[model samples]
Target: MSGRIVVGVDGSEPALKALKWAAAQAALTGDSLEVVTSWEYPASWSTMMPGVPTEFDPEQLAKEILNASLEKALDPATAAAARRTVVGGNPAQALVDTAKGATLLVVGDRGYSGFKAAVLGSVSTNVTQHAPCPVVVVRGESAAS
Candidate 1:
């Protein structure tokens, strides 16, 4: 049955790979693509040094990252065809929630941070365990090649 294919994009190389993979899969399955990104204030934000300008907008940054990731991952027509969402919360939880009722959920093996030898990022690991639908964690070029 045709449904949404949700993918998390964080402006990282691995995320870009996952986006591309998800787009191709959606094309084959006739599923619509939903590109998602999330943002949350740092725990230390409230405790930052006094006089530090606190004009940062995590949600806006998340939107920008999602837009850039879509451009890098898909052609203009394909990117425009996909739905984009920017949420405010933990990345893993956002992805899992967005994947509900979706045909599949796609993520990168790793995100912005993690040990070089780690097989999967925290978000990818969490979503795989909790997502309501099937999950695809695309590995880096090494694994793809």
Candidate 2:
């Protein structure tokens, strides 16, 4: 691998699966793995949750999600070696941009597809479509299972 393996991570089962897979890939290829997560508040935040800052922080939540997923999904060694990235923005676009010089971009095929997801599209699909490097959508436990 020429560059890092950048993997999108959220507090979801599929995202955990992607993280595990990406960790394995990084281990085999001798590349560093980057665990990334992004979150955005509601568009009408001012009118919605007037106490936005005191109520919640998007960047902090993203960091928590990334850290939780890293601890839960990967082994101690892998989790310790991987870097964490937390940002506030569209998950898909954030991941795509992070893949600038990455060897590969990995994301999970979300199991839940709600109305908002249907409208905005999936992060995995968007990254696959926009990533400068190869993208892997981890759909299941194993490729040959």
For model 1, the superposed segments whose C-alpha errors exceed 4 Å read 46-52, 143-145
Q: What's the TM-score of every candidate structure?
A: 0.92, 0.84
TM-score of predicted structure 1: 0.92
Per-candidate Cα lDDT values, in order, are 0.92, 0.82
**Tens-digit per-residue lDDT, 27-139, candidate 1:** 99999999999998867886864565678677888989999999888999999999999999999999999998999999998888957676788999999999999999999
lDDT of 2 by residue, 13-98 (tens): 87899899999999889889999888887878789877667657678777887889999998888799898988778888899888
**Could you say which candidate leads in lDDT?**
1
> Distance from true position, residue 117, model 2, in Å?
11
The TM-score that candidate 2 achieves is: 0.84
Could you tell me the C-alpha RMSD of candidate 1 in Å?
A: 2.2
Give per-candidate clash totals. Answer: 0, 0
Residue pairs with backbone overlap in model 1: none
